[model samples]
Target: MEGTEKPVSALGIEKDLNDWLSVTKSRNGTWWHSAFHNVSAMVGAGILGLPYALSELGWGPGVTLMVLSWVVTLYTMWQMIEMHEMVPGKRLDRYHELGQAAFGEKLGLWIVVPLQMMVQAATDIAFMITGGKCLKKFHDTVCPNCKDIKTTYFIMVYASVQFVLSHLPSFNSIIAVSIAASVMSLSYSAIAWMTCIHKGVIPDVDYSPRSTTTAGMVFSFFSAVGDVSFAFAGHNVILEIQASIPSTPGKPSKKPMWKGAFFSYIVVFLCYFPVAIFGYWAFGNKVEDNVLLSLEKPRWLVAAANMFVVIHVVGSYQVFAIPFFDMVESFLVKKIHFRPTKSLRFITRNLYVAFTMFIGMTFPFFGAIIGFFGGFFFAPTSFFLPCIIWLVVYKPRRFSLSWFTNWFCIIFGVILMTLGPVGGLRQIIVQAKQYKFYS
Candidate 1:
């Protein structure tokens, strides 16, 4: 027992370790591009819901939750990186890999797998809902004289486009797409903020007093928390995006990740704030679920903004779906005994895409879907699992600051999980009754 441990050299050099962990497998881009990619993942079409979130909680609670979400996500990045850096022998480069490494294979397989799949899939569906609605609106605006088109048809078309594009084999392939999506996301965000800022700055029209006692403030407060939580989510894809940063001297450079994390948050706040604050200021409780819908005539700009939404969400959906595809492909390979052949990859991935799209078609109520996924999936993916995993993997001193932070996150997530979905389901049911399938 005295001489059993291996030497440092025997542990393999940093290069060998990086290769084993697959962290450097596709280090195809610089950190800035990687930053944009991850930033894209975080600031999804869910940003559209911020106005509504603000409308529900009023100024103080709404802004507080949003800042809290940002802080939670930043903390998540710190702990997750600490776990990745702390582990010995090999590193955890993927979400499930981290789960299995920290917990056990069964927990990773049963828990992380399904949770990641649900969050990503539900997020993808959200993109479809938003994308379809945007495309239909754009169509209606541009071709008002033309015959009406069903939103479902636009959703199907959007799905088909994604089906073709999602077949690219690796994250490296989508770097350009992610970059483009990130840019468009920023573009539309700017346009949205400018539109709102202009309205709010105007002397005549103002939309203060967005929230009141219509519903219980407590319930509305948590509901907005869920929405912002969803808006800030990136935990599932964080590792994958982090892994894409170019490794220098054959070790994945944490410097780039650290820098990117800081920059990415800046980008998040820049995009999220004006839209939330100004949009609420401009339209108050009269705001639409999608802030864009609240914008007045200037048919061209509304259509322009939504056109970007269509493009951004199309790319964003594919980005999120990659993780889901990995989960499904792994299950098919190990659980179902499917060989990793080109044909099987084609069949499984496309079929999964079709299945998610079908779900999107069935429920076109964007807010309800976002709420449910945010509460059910985002809360855990962003907070609960990371906290639990950190405590298990790092073995932080019990009852200390580390312990308290992790437990706090877990409890926050638990509360959110419990209340977020109940509020969300009520919204979903209301929408379902209001839903007309193809309209």
Candidate 2:
């Protein structure tokens, strides 16, 4: 505390700016913070879409995707840690600033801003849509009168939850939300496990589908890696965690932050892997949008899972919304010299919620939205941007493609970025065609 930075006053623009700076510097998140961030982002959207992904790629490829995603995520996370070392004092909010600092304004705007905004916004949309679906499910089951409710109604409900949660006055409250979400996640995992055992379904090791071609096998492999990436996509929160923790460089506070991230990720994998394997084994061809849906759990457990899914989904949107708000506030304050009054903040936040909800209502199919965004947007955000940023900023010496691991990650990331979007777009087009016919 003696050497740590002092808090800034909440007065003039200078003070506000200084406050932001101080907050970022002193921001240090706990294990709960990191775990919640990761789970909130990855679990909600990915779980809903995993069974569909399995249906297309089969069990072999589906499991492969989860494994590969973990590997890429681990490597990217390591790169982020390295990036932190290179620029010790900067937060992710300063990515464009750092870009401008290292390169120039033109490059930062043309490359960094657009890429960051696109990926972030796309991911935000995915979470919003998933949240909406969860709400619709919750309402149908809990409020029988709401059985025939429109997607817009569900979207409104989801957005309302997000708006309130996002405006929580303290970090402790956010952690509380995270703790609740983790319990929910674990409960759902338990329900899934119980359902599988109750049905007398044995775990199958020969889960991989026989490939028709070399290309098919390759695609299946990439799909598996993408699944892993989905679970690991919350590395964006690393900066937030770093800021939330008490920074004493070589202190215990720092140890927990790092150790917690590692441990929490392991827990995440444990929860996710079994769900993937068992869900595939249980349902095989009939696996629904969510593998949880494939489970013949008790009605109460199903209801609880649905409720938790909604909470998890909304919580994720709140986390992603912060960076968007930060960007908007920074632009207005710096460019127009306009301070965010309470009214303006409320309007801006609601407007964002509205836009996300509108998109969700327009496309209510949970599986389609997740696949499209996961492949088209989340892939770039999780894999491409960080890699590109690192390659540009650090320009690591001795680039060796000959090394197996190096070549594997580079090739894998490139493939995911390239094909993930293509597959996603194709799915979207097919859904659009189907919707046109149905409507």
Candidate 1 residue-wise lDDT, 1-439, digit = tens? 8798778785564345333222344666566765776777888878988988898778887787777677777898767765654555555667887888877877786777788877887788888888888898888887779998888899998898888887876667777787788888888899898988766644454344444555555555556667877897788877766666655445654667767777878888898998898888877777888998887557888889889888888778866876666666656665786665678768877887798688778777765656666787888988778888888877889899989888888887787777777667766665577777656
The list of candidate 2 runs beyond 4 A from truth reads 1-15, 18-28, 88-105, 142-147, 169-173, 200-231, 249-255, 391-407, 436-439
After superposition on all C-alphas, the RMSD of every candidate to the true structure, in Å, is 4.3, 5.2
Residue 215 lDDT (model 2): 62
lDDT of each: 0.75, 0.59
Error of 2 at 291 (Å): 2.2
Error of 2 at 295 (Å): 3.6
| TM value for model 1 | 0.88
Q: What residue runs in model 1 are displaced by over 4 Å at the alpha carbon?
A: 1-25, 201-218, 246-250
